[model samples]
Structure formats: C-alpha cells, structure tokens
Target: MQPDLTVSRTYSGPICLQDPIDKELMTESSLFNPLTDIKVKVQSSFMVSLGVTERSEYHGKAHSGTFPHDSNRTFNPIHAKNKAAYLQNLSSLTKRSDMRTTGVFGHLGGRLGIPNTGVSLLIPHGAFSEEASWEIYLAINQSEPSLQLEGSEILLGPEVTCGPPEVTVSTPFALTIPHCAEVNPDHWTIHLKKKKEQGKWEEVMSVEEETTSCYCLLDPYACHILLDSFGTYALVGEPLSDCSVKELKVAVFGCMSCNSLDYSLRVYCVDNTPWAFQEVILDEKHQGGRLLEEPKLLHFKGSTFSLQISVLDIPPFLWRIKPFTACQEVPFSRVWRSNQQPLHCAFSLERYTPSTTQLSCKICVRQVKGHEQILHIQTSILENERDTITFFAHDDSHFPAQMGPQAFKIPYSIRQRICATFDTPSAKGKDWQMLAQKNSINRNLTYFATQRSPSAVILDLWEARHQHDGDLDSLACALEEIGRTQAHISALAETQTEESHFSYSRQNGL
Candidate 1:
C-alpha cells in the first residue's frame, strides 16, 4: 500500500498524545467524617523496601501472645511518596475517619506503587531519618509532540548554536532536536543544504562537517526528536509536527541513554521475605535494626559499601537468637533457613586448610533495572574438614540477660587460645598414686582434642608427655585461642596469597 501523500508541517495543527499521570478516587464518608470519634495507637519500628509491588502483609508477633505468627498479604499498589491525609482513622488521601486495622498496625505497613496520600507518621531515627520519606527516583520519558511548541527549523541568529539546553556536558556529547526544528517519521530526514558557501566547502573537509546536521535522536514517549548541530551541539525536545530544516544545518543524537535505571533496596535474611523486616524495624519505632530502623547504605558516589557478616561455627544455639542480646556466640545458619527445625553447617575451623568453602562472592548486576544477583563459588578454605563440620549457625534461644526498649544485639564468637586437657583414667590408687597417674597420661598437640564442659578444660595429648602426678601436670591447654577459620582466608589482610583457586570439578581433589 502507498503511504499517505498528504503531510503537514509542525505547529501547523494539533496531535493527540497520551497523558503521563494516573489517578484514583476514594470515599470520604467513612474515612473523612466518621460518626464517632476514636483513637487507636500505632507503633512502627523500621521500614524496609520490598520489591516494586504494593503489598500490605508481613510476619509479626501479636499482642495476644502468638508464636511464630505472620499475616502475609498483598494490598493495592498506592504511591506513598509524599501524599496528604484525608481523615483521622482512615488517615489517607481518601479517608473516612472510621479507623480500621488490617496488616501491620503496631508496626510499619503499606502498599507500593502510586503516590501515597496521608499523614504518614514516622518515629524518630538516628538524627535525620525521621524526616526522609524515600530516595527520589524520577522516570523520564521525554519524547516528541508532548512538549511540542509549534514551528520547525527554529531560526537562531548567526552566533546561536543548538544543543542540550540545561545539561552539564563537556566534549563530544549529543541530545535530541529540541528548542529548534521538529522532525517526525513522515518527513523522513531534515535535509541541511548549505545555502551560501563561505568558501567552496570541501566535501569531506572540516568546514563541511560544521554546517551539516547528521545525528538525530527520537524520543518515542514525548514524540520529540533531538538534533546535533554540525558536530558540536545537541538540542532536544522538538515538536516533530513542523518541517523547517530545508536549508542551513542539522544532525541527530546517538540516543545512547537507553538503559539508565534508578533503584532502591530493602534487605532481608536469605529465606525470610523482605517487607516483614521493614515493618518489624520501622513499625516498632525501635532502634538498631528495629523500629526507627535505618536503611543500609549500599552504593554511594559510584562506590559500593556494605557490611558482610558471617555467623561462624556457632553451635545449634537457639537461645542466642533473641532480639535484644549481644556480645556472645549466638545460634545462626548458613542458608535460606525456615524458623522450624533448621539445621546449621557445622565445622571445625582448625581442621580445614583454606581450600574448599568459598565465602567470597561476586555480584552480577544487569544495567537495565540495576537488578543484581549474587554468585557464590566455594573458596579453598572448606577443604580438609570434609569429615567434620562445615558452615556455621547461631543458636536461637541465646537472648541476652538484659532487657529494655533500646537494647542492641551484637553477637561475637571469640577465637580463644587452643588448649588441651586430659581425661582422668578410672584410677582407684592412693591419692598420691592417682595424682601421679594423671601426670603420667599424655597430651599431644598434633592429635585431636576436646574440652570438658562443666569446668571446661583441655583434653587429648600424647602419652609420653604425661609425666608428673595429676595436680602438677605440664601445660595441657591451648596456648592461644587462635582465629583459624575459613573466614580468615577471605579477609582483605592477605598481602601474599597462594595463586590457586580450587574448583569442585578439578581432578587434584581441591
């Protein structure tokens, strides 16, 4: 079929375009002016960002004493970025005053998407977080026709050069055809025929390149086109309705900014969902990973920053997982674990040479949405301990012996000195003889060892070293509680490292 022969210039008529805004309505009767006045208390701890969806559900303990309970649910996607309130109870843009409780009430809860409207009450955090709603992210879809201001081939004076209007660019940069002439697909190209030659312009000479426009950038959203001046300037936001570039100069922008993305992240423990963490912290109005929670700073000024923590060979310490305890070896896990009968990867850090377990990870991120996925390949440290413990976990019940609204949980597994203790043989000899028997027993450094629990003491050594009678034996305990774990292999302090990466598929038994 032949194309429509009839065509008109920009600014010559009007063209319809889609609106960029979305809207919704709410009832005021039930929310704005309730028949009875009421007040319900709400307390929030920290707020976390889940994925880019508007859901209102999360796990939380109930006031009525409930164990491992949760109310995971999805709510309508509402834009909660700086909206105003409309009621007392229904405290939202479209409020009815009649208060009703749903998801996270005593904590943080809300949906995602559209702008949020209401008196969002946030408790204090650090010194500044209380006032900030969110890090700003703007999606720009500047195209043609939308910002079209009539006309074509904008006639600038002899000295005026066209390019990006308000951008901070240096050399070799381009933008769309804006504030100048508008060109659309119907008119094809904006032919820039030099009118009068200052001096017969050479076909491929520098002067010829200065007056001819070559690069064009089309904005599909706004229906605008960008043009580069000769080879120096880039102008954008032109109404493609006009055909004015019959003479003079023109070009196009490479349209390179096709994949810029802005993102925000709400962190979560591996298997645990994300939003619940946010509500628990933000809703409780607690501090330090709790109410009034502070978001972890990930990337700043092109540099990434974050604290990577590993719960070492923590025993199945369930009691150490309390929310308000610190300064102790608590229970923990190494994978996406559930709240019930979760197992931890145990390990004797001393047995493994830095050869099997890979604690180091490389995060691969896609440029489009800035979405990142972490790649975990075992390092060389998890070797040798093949017959023993591997990963680490903190016991859950290790709640601290203190209590308060602002208590902090700082867990640490100290690597004390290595020591040895001997198991007293069932000796029924004289007191002196029993003592001598203990002394004569052996305690070897190279052999395996274990510590007695009730009055923890070192055990296991060679027999020859067992000399003096029991009480006055030689040094049997560890001389140093050295930090000999797989984590040390990944620490940045290594000035010189062995040049080998052990892979599972390698034949050398790495």
Candidate 2:
C-alpha cells in the first residue's frame, strides 16, 4: 500500500564514508581475523575478494608461452572480475597464503607492472537489507616509514564499497605509478630518480576508464634496416611507383610469457610513412604501390620487448624514380597480467588515399629471367624537380593507382617528455626520426633515424626522442634539434669551401 503521509529524503548529499579508520588492524595472534580486529565483521556464507599480486617468484609456479589471446589486444580482466566477484563474495579473509586462485576463499591476484597505485581492490561484502549493518576502514601503512610522506594525498579506505552490486573502476586496475613501487625497472631506476621522490600515494580501485592505445609502428628496409639483433618484422608489396596508391605491409613480434601484440600500418604511395594510432591493417593491392626487390625478416623473443622495421624506396639505377619496398610489422603480443583474458585475434586493411600531384603517371616495366618488375620511366619532355621517394606494387590491378608530390603533406611536428632516453643511430645502429616520437639520448633502441646530427645537437635529439612521442615536450626538443643540425651542417659546408679556396692559393705560392 502507498504511504498515507508523504516523506522527504535528502538528495543533496554525496555517498561518503565518515571517519574511515586509517591504521592496519593489528592481529593479537596468528589466528586472529583482520576484519574482526578492525571492527568490521563478515558472515560465514558471504565471500570476500582481496587484492593480491601473484609474483612469478612469491608463489611457486610454471607455464610460459604466447598468451592464448590475440597479440594486438590489451585489457586487465582480473581486477575487473575480482571487483565483480567481491560484490558477491561480500566478506574478508585472513589467509594470505591460500588466496592466489579464484573462488570466494582465494585472493584475486593481478600484475600492475611496478610502483602500483590506487588501492581499488574488490571489497567483497553485501548488505541484505536496510537492517543489515557493518563498517569499513582504511588505514595507511603505518609500519613502513617510507610510505608516510608529508603532504601526500591518499584515500584512507572508504566507509563501504559505495558502489552498487557493481562499480565502474577509475581504471579497470591500478597503475604502478613510479616511486610507489617496491621493485623497479633497470631503466626506471636510473632515469626516474626525481619522480620517485614525490613520496607514497594510495587509491582505491573501483573505477573503469579507457587506456591509451599502444600503437606500435614499424618500417621495413634492406641495406638500411637498423634493428637486426632483435628479429621481429615482415615485408610485403610489389616494386613500382603509382602516385595515387598507398599499398600496405606488416611485422610480427612476440614477447615473454603468454603475451603477443600486433599493430596496423597505413602504407603511403611515397617513400614516407608516418606512424599513427591505427586499429586496422592494410593490404598490398588497395594502395597504388608494390613491394621492393629485397626480402624482410622477423625477430622473435620470449617476453620483455624490443624490435623494429624499415620502409625502403629504391629507385631503379637511373631510369624510373620509384620505391622498391614499404612494409611494417604486426606484433603478436604484449605484456599480460596473470588473470586477464586476451583480445580477439583478427585485424583488417581499413582504407586508401590517392595522390594529388600534377604529373601524369606512366606504367612501364623491365622483365628478368622469368619474373617481371613494373616501372615508370620519367618522360624527358616533362620537367620534374621535386625530391621523390620509393615506389612499389604488390600486383597488377591492385596498385595501378598513381600519386604525385603534392599528395604527400609535410607532416607537422609533435613532442613528448617521458621516462627513458631515445636511441641514436651512431650509438647502436639505431636511427632517430627527426620527427619520431622518441628521445635522442638513449642508445639502446633497435633502430631509429632522422635527417642528421652532430654530437651536442644529437644529445638534444636524444632528449627529444626520450620524451614521450607526440607530446609537446618531445616535439619541442625535436624541433630545436632539427634547427641546430641544419645550422651546424650549413656552417661546416661553408667552412670547407673557404678552406679549399685558401689552400688553392697557398699551393700556387701566394
């Protein structure tokens, strides 16, 4: 029956936990329950899902291979499911040793790289009705002196899992914000000393947000292909130049454990190809381009990452000015957590763009012993002064599309500041894209390149490459380096010309 009298409820207040306890519950004995000691008790039928990390070393284990999931996908399901499972489990546990597997009695484990933050564990407890009452407490790690930082912002545990039977976590799982981790990467330790000093930070993980795409770009090459040691790459397409067509290629790489990743490439008709965040792969025919004369290779390793690709445009000896090759790799995997499921295993060739140049293209060819390679001989009557790039064609009807100079836009610049240094070509055969998203200081990458470099300016490029790609910081560094390199090269050329003139007079006994 409807209520005889109308009642008003406060709708202005946000759900919040008051006086959340901020200290770890000290167990009187080994047999004490952490929940009861902390004044939060749970019923026996109810289950609790605790957040745990099943370190490859912490607990005994075995089993390693390419993750069963697709290599081009990424997601953290353990933290996701645990949050869901916890809502149903609804009670806390005490046996840290027996909590690694699923089930209400087990602890939900996940891998958050290192320096994980935001304590968004699945708080498993439920309220049956308005009469059901209980309390939740969150206390800082009072035991760890280093964890207590002055002016640090941290959540002292919420009063309860304020979310409904389900909660949308801020990020499916917690991120190992550097400086907050107990273990550190060799690279992170040396370069991230400053960010770590910020002190301990904490967060509860019950929020779900999208993560940035890990867009892996690859460029194929023959004589100039840089990364040879870490073998992971693939080459495809015909050898010809069609100003309007943009053919495609792929590279595949594998990582340790059960993780593989793949990337989509957007091939262009010209020798130049800009790496971008793509969700699909492109095939040879659609783009008016073809493969090069050389074959590409793939390098594979069982885990941790590192590999590269090259895009080559080999114009014939002196006749047709076209590309010989332009293909990228498609990785088979990436880092995966213990409890997450992989994404699907399929990708596709999304689209194509024709050239907008002013020249009328021609289709000519040269036949060898048995195979025939198509070519476009420059017509003597037309005046062509632009710097053109590589040309290719995967097949006949596929790459007949022709493109021209104006079709290729002068891609603008970008910059980013990140955690590691960028690799220099001279350092380890790695090249830096005067325009790539990397730092110039790092020498460990497989392959990277840009126009050219001198010592001091190269250092600046290293910093630029090391900066996160596409961000303002890296772009700024790259721009400065480019200007410096051009200026230095120009000065050196002028100096040589003047010196040559003076030397000639001296030789004549002036």
How accurate locally is residue 259 in candidate 1, as Cα lDDT from 0 to 100?
20
Q: Write the per-residue lDDT of candidate 2 for residues 360-476, one digit (tens) a residue.
A: 222211111211122232221112433333332111122111111111111101011111122223221112433343232233222222212222233323321221222233333
Top-scoring candidate (lDDT): 2
How does residue 325 of candidate 1 score in lDDT?
Answer: 20
The TM-score measured for candidate 2 stands at: 0.19
TM-score of each: 0.13, 0.19
- The residue ranges of model 2 lying beyond 4 angstroms of the native Cα positions read 1-441, 447-474
Error of 1 at 35 (Å): 45
Instruction: Report RMSD for candidate 1.
Output: 38.1
CA lDDT, every model vs. true structure:
0.19, 0.21
